[model samples]
Target: MIWETLVEPFAAYGFMRRALVGCIAVSLGATPIGVFLLLRRMSLTGDAMAHAILPGAAVGYLIAGLSLTAMTVGGLIAGMAVALFSGFVSRVTPLREDASLAAFYLISLAAGVLIVSIRGSNVDLMHVLFGTVLALDDAALILLCVVASITVIAVALLFRPLVLECADPQFLRTVSGLSAVTHFTFLALAVLNLVGGFHAFGTLMIVGIMILPAAAARFWSVSVGGMIVVAAHIAVSASVAGLLFSYHHSLPSGPAIILAAGVAYALSLVIGPVGGLARQIPSRPRTQL
Candidate 1:
């Protein structure tokens, strides 16, 4: 009974299969980035950039009327521009990076809403805000797969520098001048994944895939590689659970996935052994003196 209830929906429906694949692909790309974001203390930056991509997509909606290519291109352009410009502002001005990103996040979200209102109805708006995961077409699914492939390769190539860049920026600068390169590269990859998944998962909930799984994993492991592995598993589990929940309850798909991730995080907070409520500080047993 349990197996049939869980596997039947996906086996019977092609859309369910596509949604599952899309969620998995996005999770693979988003997990490592989320780990890095958490390590760098930039968890909310993912949220900020998620909102920051809206204006660009809204512009595409304004001009092309829900054309996927148009909206995607617009989102890529806008997300990259905001990311780079905010980094520039932080370097050149007194405002910190978080402050600059937060400012642009608010502005971009408001502008995106207004622009969407100009051309799209509430229905269109909801699609952009929450996404239609169960209704992913071939183009969007293909895009997610491609983004996942590119992200895996790029992350593998950038691994060493990114680790150094995240763990110790000053030492990285002195040893190798790839600090700026790695930072911007990281931002680009992040924006790429978000933009790629925006049409399928929407901007608001996509970050949940990136951050929540990584957050849950932090309580499961200490090594970066271990956390990444655990995070990927968490992401896949959340996607599966979320799809099942939506299927059974007739709820919105995207939010259901995020909510499932939220549940995982809540569970991790309570029972995870690394840093969870179960063990606030991991301590080794005292050796005999």
Candidate 2:
């Protein structure tokens, strides 16, 4: 039973191995960014950026149908542009960061859908919108690994600045001259990771993998480091479980992975140690009226 269920699937298939590797790389790199986004109260930023990539990927589709390089490059360019512009607005303009992101997301998403409808059929649109994880080539795998590694190292280097900025942006702005630099740099890194992740997980569902694990971890841990660790574990678990389920059931690989993550978040909401529903028992007795 074990051999048929676990060993045979990955052992017999090469794509399964690649999918797992890419998912791990994505989980390790993107989950931590989600944690920071949550910490900074910018969780929607991930969604906005994910939507922002749609226009670029659609443009790439318009140029070259189903071309991996074109789509990746286009998505990267679009995601980065939105990230920088939003950061600039947050720093210089009176409008809030979330406001700027929301505006950009709506415009970008509409433009993308319109562009895709211009020359593509519903099948092409579906393919572009929800990418196939099981079809990853060697180049995609390499890019995923490299981006993941760079994100891990960069996050380590920027740990203190990020925490300080998240805790008190005003203080960090006044005390450290690198607050803007730190903020923009982190956003760039996040965009980069999102671009890489969306290539494998699809633009629509990649943010789920990024955000849900971190959300679940919040219910399990109070410390930033602990949350990151827990988030990574949950993400990896979801990836593996989702892949196995997809393999056995012939399901859409990307959604399967994210659905597994959703399950984890749901379970954590009930049973996690820190703030889970199960732990919300009353500690004080009610006074009789």
Candidate 3:
């Protein structure tokens, strides 16, 4: 009975299988980046960067009418531009990094909306925002797989410098000049993941994959490697649960996945192994004699 209820849908349908594969690929690649974003205290920054890619994606839609290559390239350019510009402004001006990022993202969001309005219907815009995970074609799947491969390779190569850069940037600067390089490299990887996710989950929900799983892992693990492993598990679990929920309930897929991640995040908050609510609650100080 359990197997029929839980496993039959995926076994019966090709789309279900593809969706599962897509979500797993995304979880494996994007969740690690999410961990780093959490470590850097840049969760909101990641969100902003997610929005910052929209105008580029919208432009791609305008040019290619949803050509994966065009939109992805556009998103990459926009995301990287915003990240670099925000970093530069923080360094050169009085505006703080968060403030600069906020300003730029808002502008980008408005621009993306306006561009989409000029050429696309509400349906087209919605697809760009919400995605069609079940409808993923071969091209989309291939792109996601490629992005996952690149992300794994990049994280492995940049692990040491990135760890030093995030843990202690000032010390990294004194010890080596790769601080900026490391930072930007990580940002580029993040942008790439977001672009890949834009296909599977859309720009809005993409950040959900990146942040929620990472946040949940923090409750279960202390080490970076451990967190990555746990986060991957959480992400894969959420993706499967969300897809199942969407299928059975006839709900939208992208938001369903994010909501599933939210559920995991909520559970982590209350009962996780780390400083969860259970741990944080006082043990009712022993009564004095």
Candidate 4:
């Protein structure tokens, strides 16, 4: 009975299969980026960048009327611009990258909202904000797969420099010119994954799939590689479970997935192997001899 409930949806419905594939692609691509963001203490930066893509998507909507290709291109351009501009500003001014990102994203979010409202209906805006995972078509699936593949390959190529940059940026800067390379490359990957994620989970929720699973995985593993592996597993599991739950309960698919991830993060906070609440409780010291 449990197996039937869990397995029958994908078997019975083509949309279910497509949704699963899309979610898995996002998990594979986005969670690794999330891990690096977490290590660098830049989870909020990921969120900022996610918002930064909205104006581009809104512009694409305005130009082409919800065409995925246009929206994707717009999002990529917008996200990368924020990243580059933020980097440039930090170098030239007293403002730090985080503050620059925050300011840019706020402006972007306001601009996107205004743009979408000018020509779009509430429903259209909702779709951009929250996502439409169950409605993914062939083009969306293909885009997701391509993005995930590229992200995996790029991360593999940049892995060593990325680690060094995160661990010891001053040392990496002194030794190699690759700090900027790794930073912008990772930012590019983040944009790509977020654009793909917007298709599956929308702009609002995509960051959850990216950061939540990675954050949860932190409670389970100590190594970067292990954290990434665990994060992927957690993300996949959450996607599957969330989809099933949504099917059974008639909930919105995107929020259901994020809610599932939220649940996992909460559980990890309580009982996870690393710095969980339970683990942090100091046990009575052993009596001295």
Best by TM-score: 3
- lDDT tens digits, residues 105-129, model 2? 9999889889999999987777667
Provide the TM-score for each candidate, comma-separated: 0.95, 0.92, 0.95, 0.95
C-alpha RMSD (angstroms) for model 3: 2.0
Off by over 4 Å in 1: 281-289
Report the error of model 1 at residue 98, Å: 2.7
lDDT of 4: 0.91
- What local lDDT score does residue 75 receive in model 1, on the 0 to 100 scale? 94
* TM-score, candidate number 3: 0.95
Instruction: Tell me how candidate 3 scores on lDDT.
Output: 0.90
Worst 10 contiguous positions by lDDT, candidate 3: 280-289
Model 3: number of backbone collisions: 0
- Per-model C-alpha lDDT, please? 0.89, 0.89, 0.90, 0.91
- lDDT tens per residue, model 3, 1-289: 8887789989999999999999999998999899999999999889899999999999998998978999999999999888887778999999998888889888988999899889989987887888889989999999999999999999999999988888999999999999988988899999999999999888888999999999999999989999999999999999999998888899998899999999999999999989898876664354332
Q: Write the per-residue lDDT of candidate 4 for residues 217-287, one digit (tens) a residue.
A: 99999889899999999999999999999999999999999999989999988999887888876543433
In TM-score terms, candidate 2 sits at 0.92
Q: Which stretches of candidate 3 lie over 4 Å from their true place?
A: 283-289
**Span of 10 residues, lowest total lDDT, candidate 1:** 280-289
Question: Candidate 1 on 175-227: residue-level lDDT in tens?
Answer: 88789989998999999999988877888888988999999999999898888
